[model samples]
Target: MTAPDETQAIRLSKRLAADLGCSRREAELYIEGGWVQVDGRLAEEPGLRVRPDQQVQLQSGARAEEAPPVTLLLHKPPGYEAGLGGIEPGAHASRSRGAPEALTLLQPDSLHAEGGPPVRVLQRHFRQLQCHTPLPTEASGLVVYTQDRRMARRLAEDIETLEQECIVQVTGRIADGGLQRLCHGLEFNGRALPPIKVSWQSEQRLRFALKGIRPGQVPAMCAAVGLSVVALKRLRIGRVALAPLAEGQWRYLRPWERF
Candidate 1:
């Protein structure tokens, strides 16, 4: 639960989303139904945020649901698209491509239904990458895509967003001051970005756990610390990682996959 004024700090709920003129349910309905976003990703948490800075534009003439809620884990290479490839930058064009063979295809996999007004698919889609905040272009490992909305939404979207793992390659040693700054000195706009857990995995390799993120955040973070992002690949979203999948591939999100 969050107060309207507090919208600037965290997730927003259903009633709150309607307050912003979005739709029902925070994750899928609000976002899949079309318009809503936090920091930039299609707004998933209804009560996720209502901050003036948080964009809440309803997709005009958004289509109604036609599939059952679902989730997927895609080994998104440098080139593939994330969700429906919207106005977001990188999706339009990129170098590497991903495989979507893992997911159950465009077929609907219903997760829930009832005598309620209408049933909705809580599809949660993702693209794996090096930067926690991928450039509108840079690319890498696993990307999630799907039609089973609910479970997917829960896994991907939430105030309690799951911890994501990243493997990064950088060019040069980080400055003592810059590394320190990387740990806690940057801010998006004037809003303080989330704190991160950063460490070295090798001479030119580093690992980071961003407590929070702004879309396209990681690349900027590296630049701020004077590090060039040479390559980035995501390992996991929550407990879900790109284990069995190969590059540019996808698979059905199993019932056991939710984090």
Candidate 2:
């Protein structure tokens, strides 16, 4: 008995559930798995709004067979390659002599102590995950790897724009005005480098928060300011900070967490 033209749009998951005789959760799963079509186009967001008259159809033979994508946060220890290529400083003698694979660090014991919901690890989960940023093998901090293509694409596209904060331990005298030059006046690869925020954490430690950083750029930046980088460890990326994750350990990125 609803009045004509008075039916407001409802959530797509709700509409799909009512139309397809399934639970709202199932509808959401279907939508996220690319099995639901809205007006002949695939709809991925379960929270999308749908008009009463809009067409919503479940693709024939559509099933949520694929496992959900996963993201992992690892506290990379010095020695292991963040992606590929680099020697593992502390690898077991039994391990093959080559660049240590980061995946080996993702052991069950390495999971966060206050673990959230239990997640079963499948071989497929590790198959095609793409690492977002590559930390140098000599440095250690948080590293991200994900199986979500959308998330991967976003990170790849915005990498140069995202700010990364690092703590660098150094040795040597800092020249007068050296800190100012490090903050503003610098060049990399024959081009003017972007401005960075640099500060002293301690007598021998410097804090740097910068964007568009290149591989080996941190060392080069320190060298420019009359500091020799003894060690460097990333502490933050975007809004995500490296918490108390133990070195060489990893944990599943919570569903609610975002970089």
Candidate 3:
């Protein structure tokens, strides 16, 4: 079999752009969206070199509109890092022997609902995801990863003020005036803590609603009140809640939903 001349081959995006009468970017999106096929096999790389004789066709119902970047809400289980912090850049490397990264749970099989988000689950959606919202490894609950810059920016800039709701389980008796102190009188790192909402949800469970949560802050607060934290789980961030999402599963952020 004679090898096709390399000089005669063209970039798949260029060829598809010409065939579809669309812009180069549009063609690339189509290819990256897994809607383009070459010789009946799905071809996802727009820069792939193709011979003129090779067949390139768009899948049925394929549209040229820009694909919206995806944002995922994951129910992170305890002991997994919300984001792989500095272990390996952009790689889901385990932080330690027993700990794994929550990013590893973003696979198609871990998608929360069968009838998922308004958008289809494409391989491209998983690429370049950024997780600005970090949950404590020792705690569990809602963690966010986004491919959209707007969503990323919103979460980052608003994090300090955005309210976080957590359910903490404890074992021990509270000190005198501890409930009031937990709300507004506690001092952390030599700075007076702001007023917060802390109340008992049940006999052993306490709910905390506050802003500017720090790593270990909840445990520290519990200890300050003479209580020992048995477990901690975040239930909500800003306006988004972690309900209906099982631990180790993820779902797309709805279009109407905001941070």
Candidate 4:
């Protein structure tokens, strides 16, 4: 890479703006969108310094428009933090030793083969993402993270009304009428719980569909009924289902898909 001379160096966005007769912000958008090339190499930083003699060009069919924000649906595995929550991307320096974060899996290689309709993966898409409806670190299944503000708002606002589906594996015997009590007459944190749908999926597995669930509530509910939760996995939140997504992989949320 050629370092620009201190006396003759100029910011890339400034030069591009002058060359294209456009605003600096537009030039920055073009550069950040991966449209600008400096000396035959892609220049993604608008503040990069360049000399007048260096070759500078825009990619063919380039436009000075901002890229659309994106949302990601991840099949989070157990033992990984579901939300960013003060953790750094790809690193857990601030967290307890050996505690990994699921956000680190949002890399190009981890993108599911059928990760929804084809969409270009950009570095910016990984930044500023906000995780919603966090799952417990000990449990695993579908988790959502998004950069779109409108989608974030929808998830936040509809949290109480939207139903969440979880598949819980339990052990030990249940008290008589325990399943019925689980459907209603349950309390968490000294507060009365609303009636929810619960059914036996198998001899050891139970399917629970409820709204506004709190962390640790499932296990508490099971304990109250003389059942011990052995494993738990969330399968869906509202209309989005986690099927077809392998564990430790992720896909893009479809455009028409809504919570």
Top candidate (TM-score): 4
What lDDT does each candidate get? Answer: 0.52, 0.76, 0.83, 0.83
CA RMSD per model (angstroms): 18.7, 14.2, 4.8, 4.7
lDDT of 3 at 95: 53
Candidate 3 lDDT over residue span 1-259, tens digit each: 9987788899999999999899999999899878999999988889999999899999998877777898999998887887643221122344555668788889988898752776877887888998877765667888899999988898778877888888999999999998999999998778889999999999889999998876567778889989998877878988999998998989998988876
Better of 1 and 2 by lDDT: 2
Q: What does candidate 4's lDDT look like per residue over 1-259, in tens digits? A: 9665678989999999999999999999999888889989988889999988988999998988888888999998878887632221111123344768889988878888876534666677789988866766667889899999999898877876888898999998998999999999999889999998999999899999998776567888999999998888889989999988899988889888888
- Per-model tally of clashing residue pairs: 43, 0, 0, 0
Worst 10 residues of 2 by lDDT: 85-94
**lDDT of model 3 at position 69:** 93
* TM-score of each model, in listed order: 0.51, 0.67, 0.80, 0.82
Residue 77 of model 1, lDDT score: 60
Candidate 1 ranges beyond 4 A from true positions: 1-70, 84-137, 152-156
Q: Which stretches in model 3 have alpha-carbon errors above 4 Å?
A: 1-26, 37-43, 47-56, 84-98
Stronger candidate by TM-score (3 vs 4): 4
Model 1: lDDT of residue 10: 48
Error of 3 at 250 (Å): 1.0
